[model samples]
Target: MEISAATMDDALHKALGKIIKSKKAISLDSTKGSNRELVGVQIRISDPRARFSRAISRSQLFSSLGELFWYWGGSNRLDQISYYVKNYRQESEDGLTVPSAYGPRLFALRGKNQIDGIVNLLREKPTTRRAVIQLYDAEDLDSALSPPCTCTLQFLMRQGKLNLFVSMRSNDILFGFPHDVFAFTMIQEIISRRTGVELGEYIHSVGSLHLYANQQSKAQNYLAEGYQEKVPMPAMPEEDPSAAMLVLVRYEREVRLNQTLPAFPCGLADYWLDLARLLAIYKCYKKKDRETIEKLKNKMSASVYEQAISKRAGQIKWQTIRQEPLNFTSQD
Candidate 1:
């Protein structure tokens, strides 16, 4: 079944109902329940730019941001992924690194700066269908611990706006969907702003869209307690993603090292920098490094700070973030 909605939350809400109500469940493992599965679920969000979902944990939102930046830096840090996900990262026979890392492939797949190549392509030929980012490196499936869930991303410009179509081979609707939308749409916004186009529709086509039977209650709980979505997608800075790559990499490094927030201002735009700091705060949150969260909190944009910390009112994690939080009172 297909679902289309104005926002990701509505699409997910409907998609969850579709799977939960489906009788065509996966073959049961007595050890684990037959998680309901639905094939070929197409979710099209009218505004790819309206990606902020209040229901997602600050941890989930920022971790996805971290992963995207990690990939942007051309990283293959299975060690870092292992620490966050608690053991989903795969290693090669050498036991050193993930064989088919998406970051390296996306940024350095064709030697260096494929992102620049893509930006250039869009500028040179606005209507070109060849503007595709190949994430599925087929060669890795045989050896890599995890092949990419997302196979490719195609960018198109229509009526003066840039739209995106992401093809996913598999999508865990509950756990993975929200994170994927946030990260990819942020990338989408970056490209749109840099290319000087309006943010348009985001169509996500999944081969296997599913809900884990184990997390059924959690899904329902989220549905029952809805979130306040940030509508009308925000516009990112016109800063060249290529020029900003070096600075973005540096900020990530500083955050990972648990160093002091550099006294010198970052070279990134305020929007991008605030996003990065959210991820940094999340890392500190995981470490329960309250001092660091507090430090980074002070540097963050109050609008994003409140969005990251204050929503999902009763969620236990946000309770601490609420103490003397940044004043982004206008959540509209």
Candidate 2:
């Protein structure tokens, strides 16, 4: 079945509603876990930029950013990703790296840069259908662990806009769907900037779109919360965003390492600077320093991130208070 929506939340709500009620869905058990699986699902997001959802149940913004930077950096190390989402350690084979991580495949598969190749291909011929990035390799079958769920990403330039079509072998709707949309659509925007075109629709095709038994309750909670406003992220500057992206990546590494925040005048636009400040905010959150988090948050220019950042700050404050020792000897 196909679902078309204007934003990620809209699409997610529609897809979840269908999965919960569709008689065609089957209960299945796999090596991963038990889930209700639906085959051949296609979701098209009309506004690719409105990728984020304000669903409090999911709390996906932080982890989504982590996944995006992880993939963009072409990293497979477990330590790097586990810091953002602890559950990623479960996917690691040797407790060191995740072979199925798409970073290595997307950026450097057999020393061939598929991202660059796609950019070059599209720049040469806007209408070409060969601008494909292959993620699932033949050797993945030999591995003991599961292969990448995302098999391929195809980009098409039409009507002065760049569109992305993605095919996934499997998808955990409640878990994987949101992050995949955020990252892939960001890539689409990046490619559009590089190719000098407007951002277009995102088509996600999944062979198996399933919601695990463990996440069913959370999914229902998301649905119960009802509709949220569609807030699109800031547009990438018309100029080539590669340099700013590199700066963001570099600052991200520093922030993840708990290093000092880079000084201002780092030569990034306000758009990129706001993103860099978010990493700083995340750093402060990791340190459990609510004071610095608030300070960094105040510096952020993007209001789209305010809710998520505020929520995170509140969590850190609560955690700090909970961890503090309380004295009750006098009362006792």
Candidate 3:
């Protein structure tokens, strides 16, 4: 299923609302020191795209869905979730498995022909089955080298019904929490079709769902935008592994550019538009944080402008202008 930006925004809104309504604010321990918050929500939708993008982005530590799936997934990290949207086959052990908390485990299904393989697996084993992908590697976590995510998702098929259970250890309520729902649901949809099962409920169990004080105002603004009107899910594309690679290359370029010249003097909106165009051409993911981008752009531009003005003034006064414009009058 194709998940669009609007769909993601709606899912986030619903999740935030639930947390607020339940009056269950996440607790923060002073030891962590990271000013992050976590919020959780459960969504039931037929669309698979929404779920896929949400999961990968949250897991991969990227705010953009396209970037997460295309770039991070292509990097071959076993602890991260693997997606076979076009097929249902399990991944081969070969070189794909990585060392994790649960020993070396295959996080996602992998096969030569994903679609065909999944169909075959379902046909042969028509029982309640699960595809488990984990993010927290105990070794990595204990060594303090694990990524910021501590989440796992399980897709279960029982009696021709598909259900998703997401377990999160620490959620960034402001940014990361909402996207989780969308990602898992997408996985559930893909598994259901390959196995010919009906879509079921989504159960999200969050451990820490605090709202960061800094992001409180932004969260409120998002809430004011109101819930999105429900729409039909988009069509899923055929399985293409190359597409994932393309996503990674594009995202790498974006990260490099952003980090290298973060203070480039340019118009805020114009800069983002340029970046967006570059991403589209390279088939990378784009996000909807224009406000943040704009603010950064303006800061960059102001800094450049100040430097240029200072240099120009110095050049005119010290280098360009001499003591005086001497007039050699023919001895009048």
TM-score of each: 0.82, 0.93, 0.50
Q: How many backbone clashes does candidate 2 have?
A: 0
Kindly list the per-residue Cα lDDT of model 1 for residues 1-332, writing each as its tens digit.
67888887777777887787767545343322456778887899987756656664322555666666777778777765554454344344455566666778778886866667778999999998988998887676785355778889999999998889999988888877887887788778778877888888899999878777788888888777664464543466666565565576666666566533433234567766676667566655655555546556677654544555433222335454544433221220
Stretches of candidate 2 off by over 4 Å are 259-265, 318-332
Tell me the RMSD of model 2 versus the true structure.
Answer: 5.9
Best by TM-score: 2
lDDT of 3 by residue, 1-332 (tens): 11123344455665566555554544455443434334443434433343422221222222233324432343343323332121101232443542322212222333233333444555577553535565565545554232435456666666667666777776665555554554455455555655666666566666665565566677777677665444333433334323433444454444434522222213223322333332322221222323233333344322312222222223333324333321112210
lDDT of model 3 at position 225: 60
Q: How many residue pairs clash in each candidate?
A: 1, 0, 19
Candidate that beats the other on TM-score, 1 or 3, i.e. the better one: 1
The C-alpha lDDT values of all candidates are 0.69, 0.85, 0.42
Order of candidates by TM-score, top first? 2, 1, 3
* Ranking of all candidate structures by their lDDT, best first: 2, 1, 3
Model 2 accuracy (lDDT, Cα): 0.85
